[model samples]
Target: MPRLWDETVDAHRRAVRAATVEATAELVHEHGLRAVTMSQIAKRAGIGRATLYKYFSDMNSILVAWHEQQVTVHLEQLVSIKDGPGEAGARLCEVVTRYAEITRSSRSPHAFDFPDLHGHEHAVAAQRRLRELLGELIAEAAQSGAVRDDVAPAELAEYCRHALAAAFELPSDDAVHRLVAVVLAGLSASDARS
Candidate 1:
Protein backbone atom coordinates (compact mmCIF):
# COMPACT_ATOMS: atom_id res chain seq x y z
CA MET A 1 0.00 0.00 0.00
CA PRO A 2 1.06 3.55 -0.66
CA ARG A 3 2.06 5.80 2.26
CA LEU A 4 -0.94 8.08 1.63
CA TRP A 5 -3.32 5.11 1.65
CA ASP A 6 -1.90 3.86 4.94
CA GLU A 7 -2.18 7.33 6.49
CA THR A 8 -5.78 7.68 5.37
CA VAL A 9 -6.69 4.26 6.76
CA ASP A 10 -5.05 5.02 10.09
CA ALA A 11 -6.94 8.31 10.34
CA HIS A 12 -10.22 6.61 9.56
CA ARG A 13 -9.63 3.97 12.20
CA ARG A 14 -8.87 6.64 14.80
CA ALA A 15 -12.03 8.52 13.91
CA VAL A 16 -14.14 5.38 14.28
CA ARG A 17 -12.57 4.60 17.64
CA ALA A 18 -13.21 8.14 18.86
CA ALA A 19 -16.82 7.97 17.77
CA THR A 20 -17.31 4.66 19.58
CA VAL A 21 -15.82 6.04 22.80
CA GLU A 22 -17.97 9.16 22.70
CA ALA A 23 -21.16 7.25 21.90
CA THR A 24 -20.58 4.79 24.71
CA ALA A 25 -20.02 7.61 27.19
CA GLU A 26 -23.19 9.40 26.14
CA LEU A 27 -25.27 6.26 26.46
CA VAL A 28 -23.79 5.34 29.80
CA HIS A 29 -24.29 8.87 31.06
CA GLU A 30 -27.96 8.95 30.04
CA HIS A 31 -28.95 5.43 31.04
CA GLY A 32 -26.46 4.55 33.78
CA LEU A 33 -23.73 1.93 33.42
CA ARG A 34 -25.72 -1.20 34.22
CA ALA A 35 -28.56 -0.15 31.92
CA VAL A 36 -26.42 0.43 28.81
CA THR A 37 -25.75 -2.32 26.28
CA MET A 38 -23.38 -3.00 23.40
CA SER A 39 -26.16 -2.85 20.83
CA GLN A 40 -27.26 0.56 22.02
CA ILE A 41 -23.68 1.81 21.91
CA ALA A 42 -23.19 0.59 18.34
CA LYS A 43 -26.37 2.27 17.16
CA ARG A 44 -25.57 5.50 18.92
CA ALA A 45 -22.04 5.41 17.53
CA GLY A 46 -23.35 4.93 13.96
CA ILE A 47 -21.61 1.60 13.62
CA GLY A 48 -22.66 -2.01 13.47
CA ARG A 49 -22.30 -4.30 16.50
CA ALA A 50 -19.43 -6.06 14.78
CA THR A 51 -17.74 -2.77 14.05
CA LEU A 52 -18.09 -1.62 17.63
CA TYR A 53 -16.81 -4.96 18.82
CA LYS A 54 -13.85 -4.59 16.50
CA TYR A 55 -12.96 -1.38 18.37
CA PHE A 56 -14.00 -2.44 21.89
CA SER A 57 -15.01 -5.91 23.05
CA ASP A 58 -17.04 -4.56 25.99
CA MET A 59 -18.47 -1.42 27.51
CA ASN A 60 -15.88 -1.41 30.27
CA SER A 61 -13.11 -1.31 27.69
CA ILE A 62 -14.80 1.62 26.02
CA LEU A 63 -15.02 3.41 29.35
CA VAL A 64 -11.33 2.89 29.97
CA ALA A 65 -10.44 4.20 26.53
CA TRP A 66 -12.62 7.28 27.02
CA HIS A 67 -11.12 7.95 30.43
CA GLU A 68 -7.56 7.63 29.11
CA GLN A 69 -8.33 10.11 26.35
CA GLN A 70 -9.97 12.43 28.85
CA VAL A 71 -6.90 12.24 31.09
CA THR A 72 -4.66 13.13 28.16
CA VAL A 73 -6.84 16.10 27.22
CA HIS A 74 -7.04 17.35 30.79
CA LEU A 75 -3.28 17.11 31.19
CA GLU A 76 -2.81 19.08 27.98
CA GLN A 77 -5.21 21.77 29.16
CA LEU A 78 -3.36 22.13 32.46
CA VAL A 79 -0.03 22.28 30.68
CA SER A 80 -1.30 25.07 28.44
CA ILE A 81 -2.56 27.14 31.34
CA LYS A 82 0.69 26.67 33.22
CA ASP A 83 2.63 27.85 30.19
CA GLY A 84 0.22 30.59 29.13
CA PRO A 85 1.16 34.28 29.20
CA GLY A 86 0.28 35.42 32.68
CA GLU A 87 1.93 36.47 35.88
CA ALA A 88 2.94 33.50 38.00
CA GLY A 89 0.32 34.17 40.63
CA ALA A 90 -2.41 34.58 38.01
CA ARG A 91 -1.45 31.43 36.15
CA LEU A 92 -1.24 29.43 39.35
CA CYS A 93 -4.71 30.60 40.31
CA GLU A 94 -6.12 29.65 36.91
CA VAL A 95 -4.52 26.22 37.03
CA VAL A 96 -5.91 25.55 40.52
CA THR A 97 -9.39 26.70 39.52
CA ARG A 98 -9.33 24.64 36.32
CA TYR A 99 -8.14 21.54 38.13
CA ALA A 100 -10.93 21.88 40.67
CA GLU A 101 -13.54 22.27 37.95
CA ILE A 102 -12.20 19.26 36.10
CA THR A 103 -12.37 17.17 39.26
CA ARG A 104 -16.01 18.16 39.75
CA SER A 105 -17.03 17.60 36.12
CA SER A 106 -15.38 14.20 35.97
CA ARG A 107 -17.10 12.89 39.11
CA SER A 108 -19.58 10.58 37.38
CA PRO A 109 -20.19 7.46 39.45
CA HIS A 110 -21.32 5.82 36.22
CA ALA A 111 -17.79 5.79 34.82
CA PHE A 112 -15.10 7.65 36.76
CA ASP A 113 -15.39 5.54 39.88
CA PHE A 114 -15.46 2.25 37.99
CA PRO A 115 -12.98 -0.32 39.24
CA ASP A 116 -11.70 -0.93 35.70
CA LEU A 117 -10.65 2.70 35.42
CA HIS A 118 -8.60 2.72 38.61
CA GLY A 119 -4.83 2.13 38.81
CA HIS A 120 -4.43 2.39 35.02
CA GLU A 121 -0.96 3.30 33.78
CA HIS A 122 -2.12 6.27 31.76
CA ALA A 123 -3.99 7.72 34.72
CA VAL A 124 -0.99 7.32 36.98
CA ALA A 125 1.21 9.01 34.40
CA ALA A 126 -1.25 11.88 33.93
CA GLN A 127 -1.43 12.40 37.68
CA ARG A 128 2.34 12.62 37.94
CA ARG A 129 2.41 15.11 35.10
CA LEU A 130 -0.29 17.20 36.76
CA ARG A 131 1.65 17.35 39.98
CA GLU A 132 4.76 18.39 38.10
CA LEU A 133 2.91 21.20 36.39
CA LEU A 134 1.40 22.38 39.64
CA GLY A 135 4.76 22.26 41.35
CA GLU A 136 6.32 24.35 38.62
CA LEU A 137 3.65 26.99 38.96
CA ILE A 138 3.98 27.08 42.72
CA ALA A 139 7.74 27.39 42.50
CA GLU A 140 7.41 30.24 40.05
CA ALA A 141 4.97 32.03 42.28
CA ALA A 142 7.24 31.51 45.22
CA GLN A 143 10.10 33.13 43.35
CA SER A 144 7.91 36.13 42.70
CA GLY A 145 6.97 36.33 46.38
CA ALA A 146 3.31 35.65 45.51
CA VAL A 147 3.30 32.25 47.22
CA ARG A 148 4.99 30.94 50.31
CA ASP A 149 8.61 29.94 50.06
CA ASP A 150 8.59 28.00 53.29
CA VAL A 151 6.83 24.96 51.90
CA ALA A 152 8.38 22.76 49.24
CA PRO A 153 6.60 23.20 45.95
CA ALA A 154 6.12 19.45 45.61
CA GLU A 155 4.38 19.25 49.00
CA LEU A 156 2.25 22.26 48.21
CA ALA A 157 1.34 20.67 44.91
CA GLU A 158 0.09 17.56 46.72
CA TYR A 159 -1.82 19.69 49.19
CA CYS A 160 -3.56 21.60 46.41
CA ARG A 161 -4.56 18.40 44.57
CA HIS A 162 -5.88 16.66 47.68
CA ALA A 163 -7.72 19.77 48.84
CA LEU A 164 -9.38 20.32 45.49
CA ALA A 165 -10.59 16.72 45.34
CA ALA A 166 -13.41 17.85 47.61
CA ALA A 167 -14.91 19.54 44.58
CA PHE A 168 -16.10 16.13 43.58
CA GLU A 169 -19.00 16.33 46.04
CA LEU A 170 -19.53 20.08 46.17
CA PRO A 171 -23.12 21.04 45.35
CA SER A 172 -22.41 24.06 43.18
CA ASP A 173 -19.85 25.83 41.02
CA ASP A 174 -19.84 28.69 43.48
CA ALA A 175 -18.73 26.30 46.19
CA VAL A 176 -15.98 24.98 43.97
CA HIS A 177 -14.77 28.51 43.37
CA ARG A 178 -14.77 29.18 47.07
CA LEU A 179 -12.72 26.05 47.64
CA VAL A 180 -10.30 27.12 44.96
CA ALA A 181 -9.93 30.51 46.64
CA VAL A 182 -9.18 28.86 49.94
CA VAL A 183 -6.63 26.55 48.35
CA LEU A 184 -4.96 29.45 46.61
CA ALA A 185 -5.00 31.55 49.75
CA GLY A 186 -3.30 28.79 51.69
CA LEU A 187 -0.38 29.08 49.30
CA SER A 188 -0.06 32.81 49.76
CA ALA A 189 2.87 34.27 51.70
CA SER A 190 0.75 35.90 54.39
CA ASP A 191 -1.51 32.87 54.81
CA ALA A 192 1.53 30.66 55.08
CA ARG A 193 2.84 32.67 58.00
CA SER A 194 -0.45 32.50 59.90
Candidate 2:
Protein backbone atom coordinates (compact mmCIF):
# COMPACT_ATOMS: atom_id res chain seq x y z
CA MET A 1 0.00 0.00 0.00
CA PRO A 2 1.01 3.58 -0.55
CA ARG A 3 2.04 5.56 2.56
CA LEU A 4 -1.20 7.56 2.63
CA TRP A 5 -3.26 4.43 2.14
CA ASP A 6 -1.41 2.68 4.95
CA GLU A 7 -1.99 5.63 7.25
CA THR A 8 -5.69 5.65 6.40
CA VAL A 9 -5.99 1.93 7.04
CA ASP A 10 -4.19 2.24 10.37
CA ALA A 11 -6.46 5.06 11.45
CA HIS A 12 -9.55 3.08 10.52
CA ARG A 13 -8.36 0.04 12.45
CA ARG A 14 -7.69 2.19 15.53
CA ALA A 15 -11.14 3.75 15.25
CA VAL A 16 -12.81 0.36 14.98
CA ARG A 17 -10.87 -1.04 17.88
CA ALA A 18 -11.62 1.98 20.04
CA ALA A 19 -15.30 1.80 19.20
CA THR A 20 -15.42 -1.86 20.09
CA VAL A 21 -13.68 -1.31 23.40
CA GLU A 22 -15.94 1.59 24.31
CA ALA A 23 -19.05 -0.41 23.45
CA THR A 24 -17.89 -3.30 25.59
CA ALA A 25 -17.28 -0.97 28.53
CA GLU A 26 -20.73 0.54 28.15
CA LEU A 27 -22.38 -2.86 28.00
CA VAL A 28 -20.46 -4.10 31.00
CA HIS A 29 -21.36 -0.97 32.91
CA GLU A 30 -25.08 -1.34 32.19
CA HIS A 31 -25.56 -5.10 32.23
CA GLY A 32 -22.67 -6.30 34.39
CA LEU A 33 -19.64 -8.21 33.07
CA ARG A 34 -21.01 -11.76 33.10
CA ALA A 35 -24.26 -10.65 31.52
CA VAL A 36 -22.78 -8.89 28.46
CA THR A 37 -22.41 -10.91 25.30
CA MET A 38 -20.13 -10.51 22.29
CA SER A 39 -23.22 -10.13 20.09
CA GLN A 40 -24.45 -7.25 22.21
CA ILE A 41 -21.04 -5.62 22.04
CA ALA A 42 -20.95 -5.88 18.26
CA LYS A 43 -24.42 -4.41 18.00
CA ARG A 44 -23.63 -1.57 20.34
CA ALA A 45 -20.36 -0.85 18.50
CA GLY A 46 -22.18 -0.77 15.15
CA ILE A 47 -19.95 -3.49 13.77
CA GLY A 48 -20.61 -6.95 12.47
CA ARG A 49 -20.02 -9.91 14.80
CA ALA A 50 -17.29 -11.20 12.47
CA THR A 51 -15.66 -7.79 12.47
CA LEU A 52 -15.71 -7.62 16.25
CA TYR A 53 -14.13 -11.08 16.49
CA LYS A 54 -11.50 -10.04 13.98
CA TYR A 55 -10.47 -7.32 16.44
CA PHE A 56 -10.90 -9.23 19.71
CA SER A 57 -11.03 -12.88 20.69
CA ASP A 58 -13.85 -12.45 23.25
CA MET A 59 -15.53 -10.10 25.69
CA ASN A 60 -12.79 -10.54 28.27
CA SER A 61 -10.15 -9.51 25.75
CA ILE A 62 -12.22 -6.49 24.82
CA LEU A 63 -12.54 -5.51 28.45
CA VAL A 64 -8.82 -5.92 28.98
CA ALA A 65 -8.05 -3.77 25.96
CA TRP A 66 -10.52 -1.16 27.15
CA HIS A 67 -8.90 -1.16 30.59
CA GLU A 68 -5.42 -0.88 29.09
CA GLN A 69 -6.54 2.06 26.99
CA GLN A 70 -7.97 3.73 30.07
CA VAL A 71 -4.72 3.22 31.95
CA THR A 72 -2.72 4.63 29.02
CA VAL A 73 -4.96 7.68 28.88
CA HIS A 74 -4.63 8.25 32.61
CA LEU A 75 -0.84 7.98 32.40
CA GLU A 76 -0.78 10.40 29.49
CA GLN A 77 -2.86 12.88 31.47
CA LEU A 78 -0.40 12.65 34.37
CA VAL A 79 2.54 13.11 32.00
CA SER A 80 0.91 16.26 30.68
CA ILE A 81 0.54 17.56 34.22
CA LYS A 82 4.17 16.69 35.00
CA ASP A 83 5.38 18.59 31.94
CA GLY A 84 3.13 21.60 32.42
CA PRO A 85 4.50 24.79 33.99
CA GLY A 86 4.57 24.79 37.76
CA GLU A 87 6.73 24.30 40.81
CA ALA A 88 7.57 20.63 41.41
CA GLY A 89 5.44 20.36 44.53
CA ALA A 90 2.50 22.11 42.89
CA ARG A 91 2.72 19.86 39.85
CA LEU A 92 2.82 16.79 42.07
CA CYS A 93 -0.27 18.00 43.88
CA GLU A 94 -2.07 18.63 40.60
CA VAL A 95 -1.20 15.20 39.32
CA VAL A 96 -2.34 13.47 42.53
CA THR A 97 -5.56 15.47 42.71
CA ARG A 98 -6.38 14.82 39.07
CA TYR A 99 -5.52 11.17 39.58
CA ALA A 100 -7.89 10.99 42.54
CA GLU A 101 -10.69 12.54 40.50
CA ILE A 102 -10.09 10.10 37.66
CA THR A 103 -10.17 7.18 40.09
CA ARG A 104 -13.42 8.32 41.62
CA SER A 105 -15.14 9.06 38.34
CA SER A 106 -14.07 6.08 36.26
CA ARG A 107 -15.22 3.21 38.46
CA SER A 108 -16.84 0.43 36.44
CA PRO A 109 -18.84 -2.66 37.31
CA HIS A 110 -16.18 -4.89 35.84
CA ALA A 111 -13.77 -3.72 38.52
CA PHE A 112 -15.83 -5.54 41.12
CA ASP A 113 -16.98 -8.34 38.83
CA PHE A 114 -13.52 -9.20 37.56
CA PRO A 115 -10.98 -8.26 40.15
CA ASP A 116 -8.37 -10.52 38.55
CA LEU A 117 -8.25 -8.23 35.52
CA HIS A 118 -6.11 -5.85 37.55
CA GLY A 119 -3.32 -8.43 37.79
CA HIS A 120 -2.62 -8.08 34.07
CA GLU A 121 1.02 -7.30 33.36
CA HIS A 122 0.27 -4.12 31.45
CA ALA A 123 -1.75 -2.75 34.33
CA VAL A 124 1.05 -3.64 36.74
CA ALA A 125 3.60 -1.90 34.51
CA ALA A 126 1.46 1.19 34.25
CA GLN A 127 1.18 1.28 38.05
CA ARG A 128 4.94 0.97 38.39
CA ARG A 129 5.44 3.85 36.01
CA LEU A 130 3.00 5.92 38.01
CA ARG A 131 5.05 5.26 41.14
CA GLU A 132 8.32 6.12 39.40
CA LEU A 133 6.87 9.35 38.05
CA LEU A 134 5.67 10.34 41.50
CA GLY A 135 8.98 9.41 43.05
CA GLU A 136 10.86 11.63 40.62
CA LEU A 137 8.51 14.50 41.39
CA ILE A 138 8.99 13.97 45.12
CA ALA A 139 12.75 13.97 44.73
CA GLU A 140 12.61 17.27 42.85
CA ALA A 141 10.34 18.77 45.50
CA ALA A 142 12.60 17.55 48.27
CA GLN A 143 15.54 19.38 46.74
CA SER A 144 13.50 22.55 46.95
CA GLY A 145 12.44 21.85 50.54
CA ALA A 146 8.82 21.36 49.44
CA VAL A 147 8.64 17.66 50.42
CA ARG A 148 10.18 15.93 53.41
CA ASP A 149 13.81 14.90 53.02
CA ASP A 150 13.65 12.35 55.79
CA VAL A 151 11.93 9.65 53.73
CA ALA A 152 13.29 8.08 50.57
CA PRO A 153 11.50 9.35 47.50
CA ALA A 154 10.42 5.81 46.61
CA GLU A 155 8.91 5.28 50.07
CA LEU A 156 7.19 8.64 49.95
CA ALA A 157 5.83 7.74 46.53
CA GLU A 158 4.36 4.54 48.01
CA TYR A 159 2.77 6.53 50.81
CA CYS A 160 1.15 8.89 48.35
CA ARG A 161 -0.19 6.02 46.27
CA HIS A 162 -1.60 4.21 49.31
CA ALA A 163 -3.15 7.41 50.64
CA LEU A 164 -4.76 8.32 47.34
CA ALA A 165 -6.14 4.79 46.86
CA ALA A 166 -8.90 5.82 49.25
CA ALA A 167 -10.21 8.16 46.56
CA PHE A 168 -11.65 5.15 44.78
CA GLU A 169 -14.08 4.63 47.66
CA LEU A 170 -14.52 8.15 48.98
CA PRO A 171 -18.10 9.45 49.20
CA SER A 172 -17.79 12.85 47.54
CA ASP A 173 -15.52 15.26 45.69
CA ASP A 174 -15.01 17.16 48.94
CA ALA A 175 -13.85 13.97 50.63
CA VAL A 176 -11.45 13.22 47.82
CA HIS A 177 -9.98 16.72 47.97
CA ARG A 178 -9.63 16.44 51.73
CA LEU A 179 -7.77 13.16 51.29
CA VAL A 180 -5.42 14.76 48.82
CA ALA A 181 -4.81 17.62 51.24
CA VAL A 182 -4.00 15.21 54.02
CA VAL A 183 -1.61 13.28 51.78
CA LEU A 184 0.11 16.48 50.70
CA ALA A 185 0.42 17.69 54.27
CA GLY A 186 2.15 14.48 55.21
CA LEU A 187 4.59 14.99 52.36
CA SER A 188 5.34 18.59 53.26
CA ALA A 189 8.83 19.37 54.51
CA SER A 190 7.50 22.38 56.42
CA ASP A 191 5.22 20.14 58.45
CA ALA A 192 8.10 17.77 59.11
CA ARG A 193 10.35 20.56 60.30
CA SER A 194 7.78 22.15 62.62
How high a TM-score does candidate 2 get?
A: 0.88
C-alpha TM-scores of all predictions: 0.90, 0.88
Give the alpha-carbon lDDT of every model. 0.89, 0.89
In candidate 1, which residue pairs clash? none
Tell me, what's the RMSD of every candidate?
1.9, 2.1
Residues 89-113 of candidate 2: C-alpha lDDT, one tens digit per residue: 8999999999899888766545777
Model 1, range 1-194, lDDT digits (tens) per residue? 69999999899999999998888778877888888889998899898999888878887788788889998998889899999998999999999999999999877676444655548888888888988999999999999999999999999999998999999899899999999999988899987777
Question: Candidate 1's C-alpha lDDT?
Answer: 0.89
Q: Runs in model 1 with CA error above 4 Å?
A: 109-113, 192-194
Q: What overall lDDT, based on C-alpha atoms, would model 2 receive against the true structure? A: 0.89
Clashing pairs in model 2, backbone N/Cα/C closer than 3 A: none
